[model samples]
Target: MRRPDAQAREILALAVPALGALVVEPLFLLTDTAIVGALGTDSLAGLGLASAVLSTLVGLFVVLAYGTTASVARRLGAGDRAGAIGVGLDGTWLALVAGLVVAAVGAASAPTVATVFGAAPGATDEAAVYLGISFLGIPAMLVVLAATGVLRGLQDTRTPLVVATVGFTCNALLSYLLTHGPGPLPGLGIAGSAWGTVVAQLLMATWLVALVVRGAQRYAVPLRPHARGIRLAAVAGVPLLLRTVTLRVALLVTTWVAAGTGGESLAAHQVVFTVWTFGAFALDALAIAAQALTGRNLGAGDAAGARRTTRRMVRWGIGGGVVFGVLLAAGSPWLPALFSDDGTVRAAVTAGLLVVGLTAPLAGYVFVLDGVLIGAGDGRYLAVAGLWALLGYLPLVAVVPLAGLTGTTGLVALWVAFAGGFMAARALTLGLRERSGRWLVLGSD
Candidate 1:
């Protein structure tokens, strides 16, 4: 048996690169945020709403990655490489179809989405401009997500790391040039950010497809999409989809609240949310490791292994969270400067970060356990748990009206509900589930 230290090493080997890749993935938006922030508050606020919409769609479909990882890792653990590859194949096709649908809907409803967010006039128009152009990239982004899942399930995080690095670098260069209109290219403002993302996503998608095709060939995995396998993936994925939807609804509601608070609050909330997402990548790395490890262990019929790994991952998750929380608190005063020059925006962002920082450990506990449940393929339970958590968060949602809160104070209350109330709810449910030992199903597929 691998000792605890060995387990730690194994998880880190998978997680560290994952951490890098995850953080870098968000840097694409971070790059756009910084560049557009320089254009002024209206531009930044517009990007916030548009990007929020895009992220919500992407997140809702993340079952492509999550379901694929769990299924592939399980099959591979049971010594079925072909089955693993097939999971990835189905996931890729699903992502493509899902993306196409999202693109169509988002393109048609871009203005309405922005309008619903209650952004000011300039911000709403800028949001529509960015959202319209950004829809073109959803297919590419979904492909990339599915392809990354294939490699991740195959126990190779480094390839995705390299892909993210190249993609982000290209996006930064393209967005910078297009934003400035250095040549014949007109300075497209927020629209430039969308175009740059599309260009980088196309390149990344092409590269990822090549890698996936090569894997299929090497494994002798069938090239055609299998209807049964695709349905199986969707069956496993639908519950998680609902889970993702609830999460996005929470975020969108929060964004709407921020929008109502005023332009400065909206702009600052963007920066704070970006920082939370960035810090989440650290904890998420541990969660990713948990997904792969727990699935593999359960598939191997090694319950002890899964339990041990879960304990170790929890430790790793909380440790990572503490470190990130410290960094968040320490850097909040300066990090906002990276995205905005306005004093009021910076101050609002700083206040938001403090609340998020205090709850980082709670987030860590919540994330790892959540991954463990997912890795064990308990999506149905997660679906129910998500609803319960969302409902539990509703009373806090009323804090906006009940407390007569507005502006930064309102944003702070929202984060406290988010980071404190919601995450705490998840930790409780997942923690109890883990102790119950009901999620250890294996070898049934």
Candidate 2:
């Protein structure tokens, strides 16, 4: 009992900083938008296009962090500190190589990508300029993602918190200086914005690499990449990659559905989705905590301890979800008003928020079990299960519009399908696997 409570404390310790670190990413982008917006409408639009392109690619590679965390945490828990650092180094290598490939591709296709994204006629050239310049930072950004995972696995979220905070501050300052070009620095317009962000990314990656190198040295781990280790990581990451693909598909389908409802509905969806994203990311901190803690306990051959840790996390998830749900539901009527003054838009948003409140606790269940399973290195099952969840929800995505629900009421129906139905599908799958207790992979590979 006390042991579980103690583990709860540990989970919170990790989760709180992880949450802080996580928000820095959005804030960084927001800083870019604000600074770039002053450059002109074309520049602002270009930044939007380039940022969307950058984010989709980066999102796909989040597995780098997830995979590295699992590998490093388990290895360390198995009492192989050197091995842990070695595996993390391999992840860095993979990130570097992957980042380079994306940079090359993006640099070459910046113009084509902007066109495909339907950049407005006036913004197309600017979008290409911004995107091509932004490609310069892809490698460093990927390296930062991988390195963050490495530190997280080492049970040091605080380092990433410091790194992200400092990096965000630097990025904001650099963007302002470069955009304003107050002294000596040439304000290169959109190009300057891209360059400013790139400079910050490079600095962040440099700091992270230094941290990883120092850790490797302390653990007596070689900084060189391991061929076999890289192979192992790739195999482990593939399933997670597909899992992410399914998640992306679901979001896109939901967006498509919302768009089909018309501009007002689309606007309402964006507002609701933004809030949902915030809630999801916040809950995901618990999942990250679950990953490191569960992996460590399992690696140490404490299956019982792992179970206890997971159950405690689940309890925390449940409590947090319930609290969020209550608050969301209570404020739903007014929350939407913050985003819009239109009664129709507010009504739709309010309906969506209420449904979100109902599903928030369910999402907590999905996220925590997802972390627990991933921590156990059960990626194969997760991929399949995630696909199944997507399958179960796609029909609802199609039906929301077919059901002929429009306006605020229509938005309500769409959300019921998207939030309520889709999340329940995930909860069902995760819950089934959890009860089976088969996700408890005994130890590190």
Candidate 3:
């Protein structure tokens, strides 16, 4: 195949499964919403708050996956298959250690976290219960992420998709049985929902390990414990980990601010965030594609190919975002009701959706640029750019309410500032890096 044709084919092969894996993630949230919604508004609200808090905390460790994908991709491109596998093994061990730390912290601090989020008096107990149980799954969840990162770095997306599909299916089934009390299982309510997710994540982690151990595919990296390998991975991964941790903390602050606004506002924010996540995940498929392709092109010393791939990925990301935004805008009125039956809840969500629709395309570009920089191993820029953007975000979030902007308008304004600032910084960094050919040169070296 011609070079362009080969690149396109490779991107598509990776993107389709990346998209599937991305889609399955939100399905977990959507499923929780559906099952919890049947109980009461309070149940849904409590779960939403708990999830936001927990996700923010655990998401800090996402660097294990993100850093691994880029580093391993670079190794694979350098024709170091064994080295790539070794990286994956090291990541798995690191994930186990990180997950244990998070789970211990989460279990011990669930009540404090939930209370800080302004959980309603009656909902606090339930939120704590759910979070406590869910914390147990952290190890499995991180393992899945680490394994998938390895596969994606090697341009093997299909395995992750298949694994995710199986896991999601298991989650849905377990959710139905445990939450609703079918057959011999007693109804565990929200705790049951947490357990379902934990079980599903365990299944995913197991499947991924099985694939690697069984040598199911050429890309499957065998798992072998190497203390030295783990140490090296940790050193290489710390910068990215710091970046991830800071970003999650920022998001946690954002969530805390939203929760402080009111339960209704928090619910509305969650709805908007959920919808936005769906669109973001779809665009993230393209982002992951860009990350893989960019890494590969750079690995092969093809600067022009990397540049073209970055441009094409951005185009795809923006297009997907626009389409999702339009759909979200059109469906705003009805979409909120799906999450909650409360009239007040619906109204708040409707308002939030309007803001989401307006800014999603910009948000899409931000996500795409992130992938590009990551693939280029330009993590220092990510940390710097995020700090700059938060300088804009903190002030806007603080002033919006004080300036008399209320409800959705105020929230949307905050997101606009965030999306706009981040995108501009990322664009500038990428532009400068491209013009200087620094990233290309570094990759070649």
Candidate 4:
């Protein structure tokens, strides 16, 4: 058995690289935002609308990564590297098919989606253009998701991190050159930005696919998709997909409630929510480590090892939460200034950040436990638990708008419902399940 210190080392090994890989997505969005914002308000608003759609489409399919990771890691731990590779191939193939379907749907619905977002006519036009072009990358995007899952399951976070970094650099350079053009090159405007992203995604996807194919070849795993394997993969992914969709609903509802609270409140909520999201990136890295390690342990039929790793990872989550909470709280006074100059907005942001800071530890605990169960292939429970949490959250959020809370007070009320109420609900459900020991089932089922 590995000592506690050794287990800590193992957790960090995966968590650090996972953190780097996770940030690349946000950076990609920010780069696009910066370059496209220069084109005009219409372009920027269009990008926002298009991005929201693209994110939803891609985000819903994230199970390709999480589901694949758990499946692959379990097989690897059972000393079946070839079987793991085969399972990974199945996941990759599933991603391709799913991606193609989503891209086609997205392309067909771009105009309607943009109109539904209710942006101005010019913005809607720009959004349609961006969305139409961006849909081309959906297949590539999902492939990257699945391929990254395979690597992470194999305990290879470093490769994804490297690939993501290169992808981001390419995205930034290409977006700029294509958006604004240089020398003899005429700018394609918003179209250029979309094309740049598509090209970069294709490059990244191609690279990741090649790597997975090489692994498959090395292990003598057949590259062709088995119907049974693909069916099982889809079956396994459904629960996780439900869990993810439920969580997304919770966030969207939160934002929707915030919007009803008045402009100042809404502005403040966005800033604080953004901060919370950034904080989540750090906490989620620990969860990623938990997922990989827990899956590997249980795959080897080492329930004791899984428990120990879970315990150790839980502590790390708590520690991480405390550190981030303190930072957020300490920076609250000035953090708002960075995001806005309005005194009212800044004050509201500060109040919200304080509450977020207080709940950060709870967030940490919930995130890690969620990852552990995922590694255990206990998605059914996670899906049900997510609904329970959302149910708990809805009434609490409804009260803010019903009571007509406004200004900084309304913003504070919203966060209390979100960070305090919603998060506590999540913590309760996840903690109960973690303590039940039911998720400790062994093997690669």
Which lDDT value does model 3 have at 339?
A: 94
Better of 3 and 4 by TM-score: 4
lDDT of each structure?
0.86, 0.87, 0.75, 0.92
Identify the candidate with maximal lDDT: 4
TM-score of each: 0.88, 0.97, 0.85, 0.98
Model 3 spans > 4 angstroms off: 1-4, 37-46, 111-114, 118-122, 215-223, 249-270, 325-358, 407-412, 441-445
lDDT per residue for candidate 3 within 190-232, as digits (tens), equals 8888999999999899888666555424655556577887787
TM-score between candidate 4 and the true structure = 0.98
Per residue, candidate 4 scores C-alpha lDDT tens digits across 89-115 of 999999998889988998998888889
Candidate 1 C-alpha lDDT tens digits along 182-218: 7786787878878998999999989998888887899
**Which order, best to worst by lDDT?**
4, 2, 1, 3
Candidate structures ordered by TM-score, highest first: 4, 2, 1, 3
Which of candidates 3 and 4 reaches a greater lDDT? 4
- Candidate 1 structure, TM-score to reference: 0.88
Once superposed on the true structure, which residue ranges of model 4 sit more than 4 Å away at CA?
1-4
Which pairs clash (backbone N, Cα, C closer than 3 Å) in model 4? Answer: none
Highest-scoring model, TM-score: 4
